[model samples]
Target: MAQESKPWYRSQTKVGVVLLAGSAILATVGGWLTGSISMANAVVALIAEVGALKLAFGIRDWPVINRNK
Candidate 1:
């Protein structure tokens, strides 16, 4: 039996998680610095961090999306 090559994205997952965590921490701190961290602020931070990850790594497969169709 032969093993398949890992997808390119797997290599980037670690970096992505690190960046996501860093951004989340920064957001929390920024909110705390000004005042209390509201639920909406936390939600926005979560969404923005995920969006950043998607923009950075998810779009790498732009070609695959069209190719499979």
Candidate 2:
């Protein structure tokens, strides 16, 4: 029997994670290049961004609610 073909693109979570990581890395690099913000501030900002992303992706699908009850 023939094997089934795999998906061409990566999963949503994987893609999102990569994007988030890359964004943090880029921001850190930019901050370093500017030399305005300290390393500690950059680290804190990265942590906050990651935390927000986690909360966003952790959310579950909710059913629509009717207002006209």
Candidate 3:
């Protein structure tokens, strides 16, 4: 699908990437400074968070038919 065809809010991949990057940095820095997570663990956590977000955003919303009802 073309980006121009999507709604304004739906076509926000750039914004999403920026938000994810910012959040990852904040989370890593906060946890590292507070001794909650080490630098290595912070890297792992960032990877997991990015993967989860990408998977979530990649899912397509399908319309379900009420055939059983």
Per-residue CA lDDT of model 3 for 1-69, tens digit only, reads: 633334324657745765776688788879988999998998888788767555644534212432322
Model 2, span 7-59: residue lDDT tens = 31345764676687768868876986799789888888778877765554443
Better of 1 and 2 by TM-score: 2
| Cα RMSD to the true fold for all candidates | 7.3, 11.2, 9.5
Strongest candidate by lDDT: 1
TM-score of every model versus the real structure: 0.42, 0.44, 0.44
Q: Write model 1 residue lDDT over 1-69, tens digit each, in one string.
A: 953445544766757665676778687768866778886777787677767656655564446664742
Root-mean-square deviation of Cα positions for candidate 1 versus the true structure, in angstroms:
7.3
Ranking by lDDT: 1, 3, 2
Q: Which 10 residues in a row give candidate 3 its minimum summed lDDT? A: 60-69
Query: How far in Å is the alpha carbon of 33 misplaced in model 2?
Result: 3.8
TM-score of 3: 0.44
Q: In terms of lDDT, which candidate is stronger, 1 or 3? A: 1
Worst 10 residues of 2 by lDDT: 60-69
The Cα local distance difference test for each model comes to 0.65, 0.62, 0.64
